[model samples]
Target: MTTTKFLTDEHLSGRVFDGGWTTVASVSDVTEPATGKAIGKVGMTDAAGIAGAAAAARKAQKGWAAAKPDDRAAVFPKAVAAGYEYWDEIVEWIMRESGSVRAKAEFELTLSLKAIQIAGAMPYEAQGLVLPSETGRTSLAKRRPLGVVGVIAPFNFPLYLAMRAVAPALAVGNAVVLKPDPRTTICGGFVIARLFELAGLPAGVLHVLAGRGDAGEALCSDDNIAMIQFTGSTNAGRMVGQNASKHLKKVSLELGGKNSLIILDDADMELALKNAAWGVYLHQGQICMSAGRVLVHKSIIEEFSARLAEKAKALPVGDPMSGTVALGPLINQQQLDHAKSVIEQSVAQGATLLAGGTTDGLFLAPTVLRDVTPAMSAYNEEVFGPVAVLVPFETDDEAVQLANDTEYGLSAAVVSKDVARAIALGERLNCGLLHINDQTVNDDVVNPFGGVGASGNGTSIGGPANWDLFTEWQWMTIKGTPPAYPF
Candidate 1:
């Protein structure tokens, strides 16, 4: 497939923008991970630019907060319409810039649209509670916006992750300054700005600054930013949380995961195989909820491992734009190197390589390893690639222990013929999201999406959870007459 000019100057005109876009002196070339070509360039925002963005957001938040709930709810559907109008172009940018296959890109688009639609209704939800009062005074508790919010989104699933925060924050009357991953500035930053601009959002309510960690640090430490919502690796999340804490700001961190899929001896092989393959191989297993470990009962471990190896070997790996393939390239060379190191280190630690430990440049073949123990890197850490590690357990207790062994508690799944047993096992796993007879990589717009421990900071996004994540509570009282008091 030949690449055409999908992203034009209109999209790449600037990186840091409050109401109107502005170009910066220092710009970086946005490269396509699959082809290693400079697709476009984005202006790099420095500390000054980040500070300007924060000031703008803080200034604009008052008006936005004063807007009627219905008026605030109206912008999202328009944004959703704009998103569909430019659907193909947006999906292309996602595929080229983030190395997502067509299906994954489309899935992201669908979820992003749903996120916008769902967030539109958030403003209408009950914002306060009327409480019984003493001394004939009216008592009430209300939710209020947290002024300016800083959202830092990752390269993988950039559109969805950014929208999930941006839409809800804006809907709840908070201004947002978004810092998209520099690697995916176009799809994550530019697209969002364009959508909101088309939706006729108020000036300075949304700001996009596409830069590196320095820019993120400024956003977190800025006094004007009241809260920070970050979705990235655990290492980066830790830094963001620490910085936000220093400034005494509220921070929500959705970090990395080393999730697992548990298959019992009585599990349906066909169903387990399908779920296992999809859990680990989808989007090259770059998802935070991607199943990094596959725990199988000792009675069925050999058969399950062999069938899974065959499935992995058969998956097509190539440039997503060039052909219909099951897997696409890694985001960049750094990701490729890390994935390779994980596989090699796991094999050295006595794990058997059943299929694939090879890479064709950025495209890594879907790999499978058997007899993987807790000590192996593949089992302990998140590979963030299309690699599945199979471990055998003799009992349900052992399976639960293996699944809960990791620090990450993002997502997990259990498969068994007995629904009761699967649910029981799933409840014991130390993950925020669990699936019975399903893959770990599943989500809905209405679900409370977050994790525990290293996976997140015990805060969730979406549904009613968004209200709490983006807003603060205030107690109020109204009295017709002043009460007698001694001063």
Candidate 2:
């Protein structure tokens, strides 16, 4: 077991605090995914506990919303400073609890910190707009915070994904009740709790409920929660959307993606290979925007596949905590098994396994497959692992068809030496995020990140988009005394 300052005995013993750390009757063991060993135990909040947290959040939200926007914004700078102060600890927890490599862990921390910094400015952004009015009355459209928000975050990129919503919601004066994935309770839940505590956020303003599906369901259905912000698999997202809809609550879902990296014949092979490898293998491909499909022009498919295979074979895979490795373990046995199954099924359907198809414990080697067709599972499904399936296309139309065929429309990229051509080609793909001469895996605090179709409900959240996602609009009109009434 590893010792920690953030996740202490009080936090682990299921004791509820006034800070929204509600009591838990039971606990679940937190395991180090790389070693499959119990590192600590986290309190498990059931449905009732979720309701308690939501009530607390609703109560706290009153004062939080009433405070001056600058005052609310003041807390975030302190939070950002605390994040820097505990940088090493945050990175360690992310790597340990989430089985992320050091690089990925560091990247997540950077993004998480950036999110807080960006959110600090959100309170000052224009919350309303003046509109053209008739009958000499001043008409104004204004935004108001949705009383309390429920954040259901995923295990992959846990901290950043959680904070991206949590920070912005709080900055805009809405209290947050976060339900982190049970697998990453510490990094996704408790860490944020500790940071805000250090930053002097008022009690009950931000609740951390480390829990399972029942808790999540409670969060969505709880009347006190006005909205739900979710990031996870598409299937789970559907359930969240359904539950939230039943209560007439707002929902912002950032779901699954089977993203593609399209390499045209005019692409620079060296750059394309780097983008392809990084896009598909970073964080072991646990990212929602990881490139699941590598579409190459038939003219360059042979060369691209051969080099990609070489790159995969050379990349290091091991326990991230033990050393500096390019890849880390799949989150658990199920992910490993799923990746293996995908590889086997794709091969059985005539996709050629070019490089890797082996595993040691939960660490699956970076795998590459060639000649993948739409008929194969690798092409149709979102393989959330370090496996890249290469498909050949003869024309630009075919490439667009291949990229847009998937139900997922989260992200897609085009790689070509001809930047103009790449942009034109990229514009044809049916995805929310499209990159030209770049990789599929990318995110920034300023960008409105989201997707369409199965990927999301056509809503985005980040930067200015946060205002819309976290608040509701109202139109108000002013008159000197009273307008002449029509009888």
Candidate 3:
């Protein structure tokens, strides 16, 4: 609404973003995040675009993969240099094109810059392993590139979500083709492509296909694509799974999560509010790993509930570009409506609204819900917007049970001053990334990421542990004289 130079269907550059001028940018008509109306028109990448890109990748991936791991690692610094040069400019565009608030966009850009740096020096992290003393078996197997990697990124955390694959996929010696979510294609993929290109990297090693859903479908199902990396809703994740399964291709999914937070009685009342609020309301609760359902210790439930309501009421809500804004607009109207309907439906089913359940002009107010039970649909779902449900628990055992009740086990947090209780509760919580005395979103660059079940498949995305997501171990055999196993 502010900057009238709309994006292009063909992703030309930051200056020339004219995506079909279709008002609603879409390859196959992308549904607006706010209105659910097709707000923009995008060009369709036919089968040939997929084929051509795949063909280009087939040629480049071999050479890229054959290069030493250290050589591949060098690309990161070059990328970082290019990225840092345009950090502020890109941050502004991330706000404009992706609708990210200034601070969140800066957070994303900064995190991505750090991720690139970490990856630059990660050739050591991608190490080969050897096994000995297994009866005539002295094996050393190294990670091999999955040839062409197809990355389908979601729009919510555009930079973070998209690069989650790019850094590792490239680090493990794979060529990549990134298909960005239609709504924020310009801010996400095109920007990355521009940066990588500016870094003086070889072309075709990484390509940006800027079309819509049809392009993604074509890319995911391509025979030439060795592996697929996806991050989005479970329904879309399921479709990607089905397509990959049809080809028996390897796929890594960071899908839907219904993360839960536990606030034990021993936790500092002040700390719990800050951490829970960060986990639930930050990014408008648009993160897949958002801690939407919280189980508070009954002893402190009354006090915790009051503080949470006040916090939600206090979070500044408005245009993301506005510096004073705490909560930005839900990616679009559809999300706002969906989030609103869930809270409304819960209220209809006897759930108590503690604070802030309102939406206007793409802004969904930070909401707090009490008297929530597992029976309500909102209790077990990924709201993908700012809505927190408070469910009080009688004991630690009951708290653990309540937290683990959901089908999703992506991430969870245990808040308590007792170190033993935090660790004990964290172990029993049953999720990918468990935080003790902290919010689920807190992490170091070296920690292993990902969740169990529908949260995510595989390990995680930081520090020394993140490389496992891009590799598979193979047991190599050597014959002394016709090797045979002794049972």
Candidate 4:
């Protein structure tokens, strides 16, 4: 493997992009989750810096929107090419900072590429619509860019999710003030700026800010920001929405989930086991759509639980740099503690800890819990770790009930031999994305991806859905003939 200075150098860390690459006085370390070693450090931008970014973006947006749509679209493809060019560096940063295994790191980068490509295609695909109106006029609705967008992204899947918002907003001719999680600034924010700059994106079009919650709060409330696109926990998302509402700025939030997976009695055993393992343990289960709850029909619950325990037990946990490791550590010490606390609390509440409940540093063992009741904390809460809770249901009605019982309605999966029945069940579950005979951790660039209830508010974030959030619709009429007087 060739050497790269991106993560290895101390002074190179915490790079900021307001209009150009620089660093700040206030800095924080970016530590590897598997080992609490400081792999890199990031310079934290103050509220004043965030305000400057928003102002810069507002200044850039007018010029960008006035440019030909094709010209705006041209930048994304170049950015996508740059992302691929630095794939190794990005993957290493993802693994080190986010604790994602090799496959998961690759998947994150793949999604980043897809998001950029999809954004690149948005210019030609998304446009205004003509409307039939009263006589003597041709009426049409045109989509106009909403100036500066404040994008606040989470640490888990940082690069991919940040691009999910950033790429789309820029593609639709809006400038962005992106504040990625401080834990993941190197790849998520700093590298992203470099990618766009290398793609020849104009100065101030995309400003990358790296900071903590204070910085995020500042971005949401900044007057220069026209809109806010956020992806994080439910509590944090609520704050973002409220702040944006105060300013009357548009906000799109993709929040937390206690996503569930249901396996019917007649489900193909092989498929059920496969989906169960994937839904709960992929990326060490640090995903919004990770299957926190698995509702199984009582008849097959025992056998299914045994197989799942084996699957969880067999997962190898180690350094993300190890090519063979399937499970890496949680994002940080807080996440590890939270997962452990939830697991222990659930056990106290009578949920059986069937397999794997301990931790080695940030690396928690892939855990499985049985006899998990709705009232249990683990069943109700979003355990953002490699933990799966099994709840047995006697009937399909009960399964549906269990799935919809959470405050979160983000994503769900239903598995059954009867396709029609599975569809029916999926319909009853409250979530934005539903997959039959599959896991909950599924997304496509073309689909509208957002949740209901506590999951999000305002708009979805993918393909054409993003155009709605980043642009405003204005109706225009051309008078072909003289207007008729009322008198």
Candidate 5:
């Protein structure tokens, strides 16, 4: 294992830490000797390790929940301080471990800092309310935090998405036990746990366990876990939510999305093509909200596809550390295989591959598909890879229909130079977030971010809504005035 300093204030230089890559399991390490790339091994955690963390959280949550909101907020400002201290190394390791290029990795670190700041400044919103009653005496509404939150994260955007739940889960006074993606385990939990310690948090307030899905499931099914915050595939999400239902616990799932990008006839042609290309290919398109389906106006379908093809062909592909490489490998061999299989099946069903669609090692080329239909699996299913299927539509109504065709409705986009047209399309698209003339405008802080249907419910973010997600509300009223209206 190799421990590195991701970030910390100068005073806590020795305090900040990340576990070196530890070999937890697997027959042999997946490696490409030619390029020196290592696909990580599967990892596990014993039942005792899980039970120990759960016990610590249950004990810590009791006092943390009773502590004032301001007391909780105090830890966050220091986390932000740590962000600035280790910004460079944070981005550097992100690029190396997750295979994300420098630009995207840098952006993720900056956004994480912003989220920490937003979560720390949420005390005013956490306080309960006193209400005026029609009867006579006092009426009150109280908000109570759930005890412990088990955060199970996926590999993509490892830090960015994990922190989304981490901030609010802790800010609302709940203890946290995080189970990071086995693929990106050490980067999220080990790195993040050290920062919490540097922020002056209690030892048991946050526990990092490096393990696979089974370890996480154990935590979720335990009687002590008050909530489960999950981000992953639709199939796994269903099982997680089902288990949490048995215990009647709260949950937040930011699952898969077959998100669409609608290019209206009025779009800024040059701008739309560039932005869409960036959104579909960045981080090898492992992002859930990444635009996988393109709805093009019939009037400009051919023209836009040609332009998109040219832009995609220009993206350089190589190792992430190369700095000049436009695209990087997927996290492991499994994802690379899945991306290839999806493309091959789509091609067999008559979709034409436009720019790039082939795999080498863990690298899948940026690809574009023409003449796609909703009946195809790629149309409705979330393809967490660098692939896009362009469908032509005669009008705005047809475009909206295509965008809403998927069971997953996490995000969507509208590209148009006309402000009114873009706004209209944004309003009509049934998604948690909408982008207008932009590839992606993902702000990870200060908002209630979540979706419906297979995407799951309960927002885990900073804002008034953030507080409500982690806590339940109950109303109280005096009985004196009730007799006045009694029948």
Candidate 6:
């Protein structure tokens, strides 16, 4: 592991890096979600203050975009190295603020560093095209960076989600104004600013702001911000889209999911059971791609339900820092209450609580529910907790139909030993990502990640897709000599 110079607790506050870490605004105290202890505080700026940050970013963007691509690429090595150096510090903040276990926190940090490295290389990877033209003329098309981009990231997977947009935006020569969920400001907003600074990024290139909905609205509505990239709930995404539409700004959204994990009759039972637990219980199921629904072949429903229940019971749940705990707390008390209410309502609607449905403070037990129907609340809604519902399906056609029945199309998985059959069934599932013979919760630095329907407008992120999302194409045509009179 890489190491940074020792940092005191005082250095982690939401200090602005307009030039150096300086307190520019009042801060809000951040509490650990699991223990409800005051862990730290983050700077909170009002609408006007956020706009000031955006203005600063807009100004810096001009020069950054004008710089040579190699110069821009040079920044990533330092940024990536800094990421390694600060890995432990940031992971502690991630665990405390986002309620992530050590494993999930490490995964977020690893991916965040890889995201920066990948984005840095994108400047050179962009290729312009020469096109055929009329005689004595040439036609060419090139991609240019968009102007300042506003990023609004969610609390869950705070570091990875925010950097997912910020790294790419900066790599493509655009400035960024990032607004992290206030609940996760320390890890999501404050530390991110420090990381870029350690990478030797110039002032005004990246700005981090912490606030509630009002501040997010301000960032999106700013005329100077050319585009907005958002990752959050579906309802919040709708508001983001509407606000951006008012100015017709470019937008990319990765919203919510009610993803399904389907088990075919030929699936390896042991693998299926293990993946099922990993898919739904990781990070306490706060992930957007978490397997909300598990559709099992009716012939194996009883056996799968029993085994999954035992698995859920066996997984450790406690404080995230324990290192041995597999499940951590929800992000806050509101989420805990919501999880409980959803389970209760589902039970009232005829779903059976199979293994766990209990909560101790903000920490909920790994829950598995069986006999869930299409009409139940848990079946149709995203619980956003460590709750997985089992619904039986007799045929592949039925499984596919049931999976596509919801408005969400973010992710789906099909587990089966037969490759051809699983591939065929995967084709029929309506989601942005499919994990054949695996589970629904999966992500990579390379893969087009996004969704359709209410989940999002089908914009993609990752790999070359980000280049396409973050830049605009321009066509140029020139005559070799003066043209003759038109026919």
Winner by lDDT: 1
Model 1 local distance difference test score: 0.91
The Cα error of candidate 2 at residue 240, in Å, is 1.0
For residues 364-475, could you state the per-residue lDDT of candidate 1 as single tens digits?
9999999899888998989999999999999999999999998899999999889998998888889999999898998897989999999999999988799999999999
**Native-structure RMSD, model 4:** 1.8
In order of appearance, the predictions have TM-scores of 0.97, 0.97, 0.87, 0.96, 0.89, 0.97
Clashes (backbone N, CA, C under 3 Å), per candidate, total: 0, 0, 26, 2, 1, 0
Q: What tens digits encode model 4's per-residue C-alpha lDDT throughout 1-487?
A: 3355433463356567866767788878878888888887777898988987888788888898888877888888888887777788888888888888888888988988898888888788747998998877889999988889899988888988998899888888899999989888877777778778878898989998887878888998888998999999999999999988898999899999999999999999888999999999999898999998999999999999999898888888999886689899888888889999999999999999989999988889999999999788898889999998999999999999899998889999999989999999899999998999899998887789999989888368886688787899999999967778998
Candidate 4, residue 35: the lDDT equals 80
User: Model 1 reaches what TM-score against the true structure?
Assistant: 0.97
lDDT of 6 by residue, 1-487 (tens): 6444423465656554453566756778889888888886667878887788888888999999998888888888888887787778878889988989998999999998999898889778845788988877889998788889999999999999999889988988899998889898778877778778877777899888777888888988998899999999999999999999888899898999999999999888999998889889989999999999999999998999999999999989999987679998999888889899999999999998888899888989999999999899999999999998999999999999999989999999999989899999999988999889889988898878999988888899988788888889899898867768888
Taken over the whole model, the C-alpha lDDT of each candidate is 0.91, 0.90, 0.75, 0.87, 0.75, 0.87
Question: Which residue pairs collide in model 4, if any?
Answer: 14-42, 14-43
Please identify which of the two predictions, 2 or 4, would achieve the higher lDDT against the true structure: 2
Count: clashes, candidate 5: 1
**Best-to-worst ranking by TM-score:** 1, 2, 6, 4, 5, 3
User: Which regions of candidate 6 fall more than 4 Å away from where they truly are?
Assistant: 1-10, 482-487
The TM-score of predicted model 3 comes to: 0.87
* Per-residue lDDT over 1-487 for candidate 2, one digit per residue giving the tens place of the 0 to 100 score: 2244655677766543448555567888989999988877878888988888899789989999999987899999999898888888889999999999999999999999999999998888888999998877899999999999999999999999999999999998899998888899889888899889989999999988877788888999999999999999999999999999999999999999999899999988899999999999999999999999999999988989999999999999998999989999899899889889999999999999999999999999999999998899999988899999999999989999899998899999998888888888888888999998889998988899999999999989897789889999999999887866897
Candidate 3 C-alpha lDDT tens digits along 1-487: 2232223334432221211111222244444343344433444455567677777877888887778766777778888887777777678667755566777888888888777777777665636777675776577776666688888899888887787678877777778888888677666776677666656556678876666667777887888898888888888887887887688878877788888888888888999999889999878898877887888988898899999999999988876555667777788767778999999999998889999888788888899999899888678778988888899899889988888897788888888889897888789887888878877665455566677787766646666655666666666767578755796
Query: Each candidate's root-mean-square deviation in Å?
Result: 2.1, 2.0, 4.9, 1.8, 4.6, 1.6
**Error at 253, model 5, angstroms:** 1.4
Candidate 5 per-residue lDDT over residues 64-168, each given as its tens digit: 887877788899999888767777776765777788888888888887777778778765473678897765578889877788888898888888888878887
